[model samples]
Target: MEEELISKKELLELKGISYGTLYRWKRKQLIPDEWFIKRSVPSGQETFFPRDLILERVDSILNSKEETSLDDLAKVLYGSPVEMNITLNELVERKMISDAARSAAEPFITGPTDYYGALTVFSIGREIDSGDISLDDAGTMIRSMAAAEDREMLRQGVTRLYRKQGVTFCAIISDASKVSMDVSSKLVLEISMPRAAAAFKAKLLPNKGEEEDE
Candidate 1:
């Protein structure tokens, strides 16, 4: 079969890429290296199988949403598409994320998860501003609420709380996590968060012997 060939100038115009970027892709092995054939009797050099491959790579890059540089784009344009998919899946599995949470990380995400993991929710047991309710009054309120069987339901939560530089942090829990009950007085909300989240955000201590909850 006859291979179509294009000059470097023609290639750049067709691919809508600058010459330096194209050369950089070559240096990084992001694209298949071109062959240089030299004949002692004739011209300087020749590059074979050039244009079609470059075009194929450019098409792939244009279609992708990722903000890739020339070299990275060349890598994708030249490398197996499946490797990228597998790498992303591996990252998600390492984070201890389950299948359900993985699905919610949609089109914008390159990975299987959107960094959602379990969080440690602490109740300060008082309003942020003590002026709104005295500490003693807030304690009474909490005690009253905790005494009721439906403390969670009775409390009207922060719908439009005016605060300084704070917002809600959403997270997901592992399927393994559940309420552990014992003959004691506390309810243990066992959770499995990603290592990064558990370490930095969840405020949960490492694996330990937890007291059995009632």
Candidate 2:
């Protein structure tokens, strides 16, 4: 199915952001160039964006711009392998991961968690929080994600949960577009790592109008 799109004019008005701000974000690489889909309109050429993706991205930017520079925000949104170690407490305090995820992941966690480790826990936590996956199934998912040799793949790959014959399984694939599942298995959930990373980073940044305690 073709993606639902919103025109540039509509986006600007709906989001209450000026064209200059939008273009500035584009120049800073915070908003990807490819997302600007130009098409022929009756009035002339017009630009558009994937509706849901652009809306969420703009909200993330607006929420984080106060606490983070556009460059740092770009790095968090588009850069690969964010090099940072975060303690479990820090993750919770920063609102990067939910309490449900923390509870489900604490036993498996050893010490300071890296980006992928935190993402794995956060992803599983989301499933558990949503009541989609049981805590027992989360263990399997966590182990599978952790066992991946190329940890970087988990950074931008797709994570899927499947159930077959009363057993749960997890798989990570780089291209979500080409996913093919077994006929007998029931697909439970699929999380886009890139989107998850964006949301995570947005959460990591201090909320707008909120000051950090010294």
Candidate 3:
């Protein structure tokens, strides 16, 4: 990767804060101090950083400023020199507006679905209810996913979850779905378990008759 550096002047312009405040923040160690290397410049010496590093440092301020004191903001945003989840909760507990209006002191958290990453498959099984004629028509099909091919099939399966039929809710318990080998690339056993159904199902059944798949 390439380095991202910014001169002291550049940082000031980007921050739009006065030199006095900058020096004050420096004294407080809100940013890199010793790391702020000085280099030769036309006007003698100038402090700078690789632009990316500067941006990274700025991002360290997980908690943004609003009306709170700088100390409070840093403490809430960056936690202590030692981090604990509770420290981040302080700003929010005080109801300081760091993000939006209502989300003033909230944590900036995201989830797995919030990001796109490699998905993991635990186990593959079908939901076997004495209903759904399709179950009897085809003994069971199985497709195991441990590679890119499996993920793609999973995507298709998840997409069809709302519209398709292979992964249907079973009447066995409060929460369970019927699954089959028809939509998997895994073991070809039509065993139904508690519903935490897979995203999609692929048809590779041994039945001689062609059954239109979802």
Best-matching candidate per TM-score: 2
Shift of residue 188 alpha carbon in model 1, Å:
68
Candidate 2 regions with alpha-carbon error over 4 angstroms: 1-5, 16-20, 37-46, 50-53, 59-68, 207-214
Best by lDDT: 2
Kindly list the per-residue Cα lDDT of model 2 for residues 1-214, writing each as its tens digit.
5899999999999989998999999999888777899999999999999898899889988977787889877877767556667777777887666787777777778689788898888777777878888888887888888788888778778888899999889899998789778899998888878767766665555543343343
Q: Among all windows of ten consecutive residues in candidate 3, which has the lowest summed lDDT?
A: 199-208
TM-score of each: 0.30, 0.80, 0.33
Q: Could you tell me the lDDT of residue 201 within candidate 3? A: 11
TM-score of 2: 0.80
* Local distance difference test, each candidate: 0.34, 0.81, 0.34
**CA deviation > 4 Å runs, candidate 1:** 35-48, 62-66, 69-75, 79-214
Candidate 3 Cα lDDT to native: 0.34
lDDT of 2: 0.81
Candidate order (TM-score): 2, 3, 1
True lDDT of residue 214, candidate 3 = 12
Off by over 4 Å in 3: 56-63, 76-79, 82-214
lDDT of 3 by residue, 1-214 (tens): 4445689898878867678877776666555454487889999999886675455445443224444466754443222321222222332343221222112111122122110111111112122222322432221121122222433333223311111244432111122244433434322232222112211110111110222231
Q: Output the lDDT of residue 158, model 3.
A: 30
